[model samples]
Target: MQAAADQGVEAIRILGVKLINPGDFFELLLRFLFNLIVTVVIIRFLYYPHSRRKDYFFIYMIFSVVVFLVCYSLASVSLQLGFALGLFAIFGILRYRTDTIPIKEMTYLFLMVGISVINSLTDKSVSYAELLFTNLVIIAVTWYLEKIWMQKKEDFMDIRYEKIELILPERRADLIQDIKKRTGLNVYRVSIDRINFMRDTAKIRIFYRQDSNVGPISKEAPKQTPPVDS
Candidate 1:
């Protein structure tokens, strides 16, 4: 009778221990789901539109999803540090031959990875409300910077200027003045290509500022003198 009672107490304690462990299957599923949802949301909403190449956006989405799943699963198993370092090393090698990514896109990738790292290191039972809030803040700030500040300031100001080539012969001073007036930029350097002695014509080329505006100059027809008839 006493032995039976002791066995019952031991059984209850075993069940209690199982309940309190953080490695339970349900808890692992919940953490993975939370991380997966936020990561996908960030990639789709914040990172996709800024990318110039549609193919890159698709690749980014797929890569982020896989990374999130692997990182979350590793976290559940409490092997986060080892996994993170290995993944970092792998990416470092991958970056060597990879095409350049825009700074904005790189920033988004960093944020996504940073969030995954934080999620992996956090306790399983901790409320995910704060995690969700942090993701929202990151996405909002990145979106605002990319759309409102960077694009507006750099759009027209960073024009690619080139040297000008002139195929018509005209007065040098008049041509220079006309170019300045038309482009709103001072010519930095001017090179005279050739002079035709037969036609008394000249070809000139110029190097000018990129942001300077250039357009065709309109000419007014010369007025005819009235005939001085007897």
Candidate 2:
């Protein structure tokens, strides 16, 4: 009876190993947790602030959740090719009718998705050094592309308009030109806010270009040519 009990115990241990290997399970759990944390961070820092429409945020969050589940499942099972093709077809049919996202924001989304995919496929027992190196590479590439190389100087320029009340017989072309020269922004449109003949002041709004900080405009004036000799 004792021998039989020992055999049963050994068989149970083998069964456990076959059912779910500790290394595989641990790796999956770690990947899931990491993906969740990173997704949350990206949603908070990148997605929530710039997105004006509430529907965009909602859709983005839902997409992230779906991506997480698909990646997790992929790591566990060898999905059939037909199913993968079907997924592609389904995603192709999804239409987002909204304002275009800036390149910077799109890059962040790509990075987040790439990281999730990488983590899902990574082996659990990889050395710490290798893991750290891979992470550093990802960070370095993302920073180089988004912050250093792809960022535009024009985006930093602050262009705003101020509304004023005044009345004049002619358009304020000279004043608008002066403001453009000083602010280095071309005024695109102007609107009349209010006009009170009795007050003798026409409320006007001036749209000008200015840097992010109201400072000396960087635009240089066109050189004046001397009069041609007769």
> Which RMSD values do the candidates have, in order?
15.0, 15.2
- The clash tally of candidate 2 reads 7
Error of 2 at 62 (Å): 4.2
lDDT of 2 by residue, 1-230 (tens): 97776556545655456544455567667767766665665566444543444665565566656765677677556653444455445544442344566454555555565556555555557764665576567666655654445333232222233323212336566556655576556564455666656645545555554333343343345699999999
User: In candidate 2, which residue ranges exceed 4 Å CA deviation?
Assistant: 1-23, 40-62, 79-103, 123-132, 144-152, 155-179, 182-230
lDDT of each: 0.59, 0.54
Clashing pairs in 2: 158-210, 158-211, 158-212, 164-204, 165-203, 166-202, 167-202
TM-score of 2: 0.44
* lDDT score for residue 126 of model 1: 63
Please provide TM-scores, in order, for all candidate models, with all chains considered together: 0.51, 0.44
Residue 215 in model 1: lDDT: 28
Best by lDDT: 1
In angstroms, give how far residue 81 of model 2 lies from its true place: 10
Flag clash pairs in model 1. none
Evaluated against the true structure, the overall lDDT of model 2 is: 0.54
